[model samples]
Target: MKIVESHKTDVDNYIITHHYLRSAPAGARLRLWVKDNSDNVIGAMMWGRPTARTYDYNRILELTRLYLIDDTEHCAESKALGMARKYIRKHLPEIRGLISYSSTGEGHKGTVYLADGWFAVGVTRAAAWNKQGRKNIDKSQKIRWVRSV
Candidate 1:
C-alpha cells in the first residue's frame, strides 16, 4: 500500500463509492489516496479551508473527509492520514496547523486522530437541526482535534 496525491474528481468518486456518508467534500484544497498493490484505492482523505470561523483560515487546514474500506489490516487508516499530513506540509508550506472533528452521531470518537498524535480539544455541545417540520436531534457532537505542523 502507498499514499499518493489524488485529483478532486477521483477523490469524490472514491468517497461516494466507499464512504458511509456518501458525500463529497466541497472546497477541497488537497486530496490523497491509499492504493493497494494493484493500485485499487483503499482509502481517501480530503483537506479544505475551515468551514467555521474558529481558526486562522490561511494557516489552518481542516480534514474534511477521511474514509477507508473496512476489514483492512490495522493502522492502515492512521498511516494514510499521517502520509497525507506530511504531503500537506511539504506541498503547502504556509499551513502551520491542522484540525479535524469526528462526530458522535456517526459513532466516531476521533481514534485515528488520537493515535496520530492530535490533541483532543473536547466535544462541542450538541445542537439539533429542524427543517420543514422535520425534527432530528443533531447528536453529532464534534470531538475537535488539532495537530501543529
Candidate 2:
C-alpha cells in the first residue's frame, strides 16, 4: 500500500461513510489516503489538534480519524501510519509528536497503534460535552497513545 496526500473533503467523506462513528473530524491539519498497488484508495487518516487542553497543540497532533476498508490487506493500517509519521517528520518540522485515542466503548484494543510503536500513556476519564452543545456524546473512557514524529 502507498500513502499519499489527500484533500479534506475526500478524506472526510470516506471516513463518514466507512468509519464506525459515521462522522468526520472537527478539524484536520493533514489528511492522507492509503492506496493499494492497483491505485484504489483503501483507507484514510485525519490529523489535527487534540481536543484536550492538556496537550501542547503547537507541537502535538492527534490522529482524529483513521478509516480502513474491511477488505484491506493485512497490516495496511500500520504501514499507512508509518508512512504518515515519516511524512509529518519531513513536511511538518515543527511537530514533535503524534497522539491518538482508542475508545474502549468501541471495543478498540489499539492494535494498529501498538503495531506502529505507539505506547499507551494513560486512560482519559469519561466526560460529557453537553456544554459544547453536542448531545449524545460518546463518554466512553479512552486510552491515549503517543509516538514521536
RMSD of each candidate relative to the true structure: 2.7, 1.6
| lDDT (10s digit) by residue, model 2, range 1-149 | 88888764888888888887777767799989889999999889999998888989999999999988889888889889999999999999999999999999989989999999999999999875554665535679999999999
lDDT of model 2, residue 140: 90
lDDT per residue for candidate 1 within 31-135, as digits (tens), equals 888888789878888888986796888999999888888867698877877887788789999999999988888888878888889999878877665434433
**Ten residues in a row with the worst lDDT in model 1?**
130-139
**Candidate 2 displacement at residue 98 in angstroms:** 0.5
lDDT score for residue 29 of model 1: 87
- Candidate 2's C-alpha lDDT? 0.89
Q: Considering only N, C-alpha and C atoms within 3 Å, which residue pairs clash in candidate 1?
A: none
CA lDDT scores, all candidates in order: 0.81, 0.89
